[model samples]
Target: MRFANQTATFGVAALLAAQPAMADVTPQQVWDDLDAYLQSFGYEVSATESMAGDTLTVSDLSLRLAIPDANGGLSMAMEQMTFTDTGDGSVRVDLPQSIPISVDVAPEDEESMQMVIDHGLEGFSMLVSGSPGDMTYDYEATRMTLALGSLTVDGEDIPRSAARATLSAGPVDGETQVTVTGEQRHIVQTASLGELAYDIFGRDPEVDGDSENSGMFKGSMSGFAIESDSTVPMGLDTSDMPALLEAGFSVSGRMSYDASESQFSGTEDGKATTGESSSEGGSFEFALSPDGVRYATSAQALNISMTTPEFPFPLSAEMDEMGLSFSAPLSKSDEPQDFSLGLTLAGFTTSDMIWNIFDPGQVLPRDPATIALDLTGKATPYIDFLDPEQVETLEGGDTKPGELNALTLENLQVKAVGAEITGSGAFTFDNSDLETFDGMPAPSGAIDLTVAGANGLIDRLVEMGFIPEEQAMGTRMMMSMFGVPGSEPDTMTSKIEVRENGQVFANGQRIK
Candidate 1:
């Protein structure tokens, strides 16, 4: 899988570099620039170039890249590509209808594998504007498709029916702008697709030809779009991520879709099972740089349903919204670096059939559940994770990689079953005094918490036999020791604190 991903990345880079530029740019200059760009990434590029009138034709274009650690490599070939001067300070690009790619990967001390893929395009058009150093490309296509042609393992061809995969997208439009300044190249891209779909199937070759031995998956997405910006160093090596970051490489992007759905069917434990899932909308964002990395995703109006031989009834679930976000530093630093994390799952509910398994009498409230958290903190790292050598040293288990300096809980909430809990807190850790906490950093801070309908929820739990009366009594006693009764019935509030000297307290009373 890693080798395949590397091959794809190289293929994309080659295609992007081949895009022509306009405004007094000659066909020969465009070809030269393409060659230089691919060579910058250590790809062996070769092609036959010819000129006729205002058109420049490149035939038998090939790109080959060798993987460093793995004793393997990949190669891609395209039949023909053309760049024609339009006489109006713009160039029109003509791409082949089909492209074939081949990849060979051999992991250390493992059997070798090879893959063949075919890419197709229909009704595609592209126009390039601006100079070679600063270019703009506008492209559109009616449809595009990718299909797995063949696979071979250990020099033996695998049966075509054993594995199959295909992906298709239609009515796509996009634009790319590239600007070069001194040692840096800045790229900005925006694209959108009316719809996208995929299909995959697999069967165990060792198993007899039976429907039960095969599995299939299909999915589709609508109104998909993406926007991205990146800053890359000139003549940069794609490998050696640590060096890439040191050379000032960074990228950020966002992808979104209006709707999506998927379905899967297979046999599990000799029993048939099937499942389907759908979502109204979703979006994802990511960024990477020398300083840190950031990622976030959100979805809305999600629903899932499934059936299996083990279950007598179909199961289903629904969620109104789900979201998650995380960001942290990767570089080594003596001083603390900023970090954050957040998660939210709101309006989550399950089918009554599932609820009945645990709450048959429906003694507990069936209201949708909600859980949320938001946190921020600062930490110091002793080694740069992106550096392979440093990673190996840290992985030896003799060194501590980092230490937490501070943390702040901006918000936390959990609501369900006729009860709700909320809290907020902040803390600073004394990394120099791990002995005070028995090998853990000493922390000093305070947290304020509130609970609503706790007593009523406890009573319902006891009545439903989920908990014994003795346990309920012990729980209430523990709450009373730390919390004060609120004005509202069944509500309680509490304050928990840790002093600089490692003393613990509840409200104004010292506990340790």
Candidate 2:
């Protein structure tokens, strides 16, 4: 139920944001442009318009759009909206204080559900200005909110107390500039908010005079900001995302926040549990185009704690920094396209309670653990993954979708307890002779790695009974066979190589 409402809210918001405000816009022109924009996306738009001297009043405005791949669609209504010509070549937009949005979702083989959401605003203002090919809009608000109004399932209304959800943001300001060229609309937007928050609570209806499950979630973020740039084809159907992309739709955006915190509590089967998490700061970036897609996110100083009836002690963990990033091509290409992936988790540590369970005598160093990786590669894609028809063909297993041509391990590091490892490598694959590698692409490359404190860590593990003495001996013998001793104590270095002829070597010794 909550999931359904959230999906509707996000869908409506995205569609609204995607609508382009045309240039040389009068009050009537602006309204006409909005109507055209919605109609282009297959939405049924209806409204009553009245004019008085330099002002236009739009009443009973309603919009309906079919939900793709679903049995039902979405409907939205607003009581009133007003546009006034300020006589200075600009227009003012007055929106209703409250807007109601309704969605009907009928999943295949499931009962239909209806959800109503109320969007509210306080002290909001919007102004539109500029000429025939370019336009600008400035807007601000003291507070804005969205809350679940009602829910109906199988023609029966659910009690209000059974579910509740609300999201709010305060003191927001934003600006958008739209420029139209031959057949494309270029849009740039920037926005900032002082704070944003959400709360959701749900409880199963009483059965036999007793409730079996309930949960609540609350969270907040401060100093939120975002910037986005997009190029959209005119008269494009947004409902068909693959078609839209093929029509030259592209977007890039970045968002950042100063601080965030969240808490959750739930009860199930007579057991109660709670959890909380906080982060000092975080940022996210994304890009999408006909050629490829990219996403990256990073956070700093994260802390988490949890408590449950099944655990006697509270569990906690902390990290100084965390990050993840990935990029890959989406369109087909005869030549190799660039791709990269990376992950980092630095300065990670957990509570002593967790460590004590495994290391009662503290035989190993209690240092912060870190893991990092950076990889770049090249691959030729035979078919566009974003195209549904090509995806179906690929899924049918009639032909390979792509081939990996090259890969470079630019960086790698892992450190924990009393041991550490670091390495870097690059490889190129041959697709002609898959049989030599057992139906896998053959690779030719070399990786150089260094290890420190491995023997000491193994000894500590043996003392803790985590590793049998015989197994430890075998491990040491294997290490000696593959690596040469480094200058430092308990340190070893090795170079692993794979030849084009399928031969493998470690430290210049032929291993296969």
Candidate 3:
């Protein structure tokens, strides 16, 4: 029970009493010990001072780490951070920052991270300890929870919540096992679809134990309730009311595991009740590493019927599967993992899916669509290694930009909307800007893919305005497209080729 309380859940309130290690060690020794500990983790510590016998202050402390690029490349620099410890087991670490910070992760590589604003701390706090294995740190709102309207994660807007955590340090075997558990309660506006989270979804339906242990870290938890009904945010030119009838509404069950990685498993076992009609249930699960790697999967069984507010026909999405996975930044020499997904809209009985795709703008080119998705594909970057900036930040005075590194990606693929595509590639970002360092364009890279899809894509594109009605009539054009639309069932075969060189081709003929 030594750590039983903090282990129960997030918001656990408990502080470690004075450590027995302090018995023979003076505060100065504690400061030195602490400083040394941080140094092992790549931190730069300048001073360790003891005040009034028990108080200690460590100044000029900082740390640096490297993050991934869009292509899974590493930055040539390290991320920078500073911290101040009050010596009372409480510490305030400055936010992670960049030297001439670009505010973009893999600034030179990723394509989907469009908004690109990044670099900063959400928040964190932890109890300081020694014996190497006995330590605890809790971070409740790292950037991950901001998907909701709360301006941060879970759509909850509050300064970061706290999570109490620790590792078994003083075991007789000198074991180094760590464990953490926590939660954050955030308020969300019903208007934003992002306002809800699994943390707020379903209650285990029954929770019983010491009232004091409820919500404490390392404790067992049961019976929880997370239910919410909200609308997706309305974009420019889009009617606010339509989202209430068109957006995705869901509920889920969640589970967590903490080992070498922090993983979460949640089944869509909830519902996606679209528009006025709600689905019976859906489920999803995933494992995410602090370093940014991810693994996930989800499926849903939907049945809905509505008439009053919106949506033209009653719908039923009897079966569907969505799979996704991605590995974090690749060190100069790390291997790449594929990120891909598969979705099947069987019983396409719902006019909603068709409506969503054809009228994706939801504000323009309103057209009709009816199609089935049986596609597969893959995604991986052209490179994965640190750029010079990243290297500088991570070295933190110990190493320099010239240090040697490596990065590699094997293969990545995905399928859906009637297309199957695959590709592989890699690149490196060294300290020299090519302009001064060596002479080259930002260590460029590339990926090439072969795709073939169901013929339905062309007519759908014409209907969706992606292609002209005339273009849809040509068999040669369909063969050259990246993929065919799903609206025309008779058109079920086409081959498409795409490459970093920027060209679309079918049978070696350029079409775009």
Global lDDT scores for all candidate models: 0.82, 0.82, 0.31
RMSD of 2: 3.5
lDDT digits (tens) for residues 1-512 of candidate 1: 13223423423422332243335666666566556655655678889999999999999999888876667776778878888877776677787888777888899899999998887878878766778777676777898788899999899888878889999887878877777788877778787867989999887776763344778899999998888887777676677666777888787889899999999988743577899999999999988888888999999999999998889999999999999999999888888999999999999999999999999999999999999999999999888887778888876799888999999999999999999999999999999998988999999999999999899999999998889999999999999999999889899999999999999999879988
- CA RMSD of all predictions: 2.6, 3.5, 19.8
Q: Residue 33's C-alpha lDDT in candidate 3?
A: 38
196-308: candidate 2 lDDT, tens digit per residue: 99999887766313335889999999998878887767776665556677888788889899999999998886577899999999999988887788999999999999999
User: Which TM-score value belongs to model 2?
Assistant: 0.93
Candidate 1 Cα lDDT to native: 0.82
Question: On a 0 to 100 scale, what is the lDDT of residue 342 in model 3?
Answer: 35
Task: Tell me each candidate's TM-score.
Answer: 0.94, 0.93, 0.29
Model 1 spans with C-alpha error above 4 angstroms: 1-23, 209-212
Q: Rank the candidates by TM-score, best first.
A: 1, 2, 3
**Model 3 residue 175 lDDT score:** 11
Candidate 2 regions with alpha-carbon error over 4 angstroms: 1-25, 40-42, 206-211
Please say which candidate is ahead in TM-score: 1 or 3.
1
What lDDT score goes with residue 290 in model 2?
78
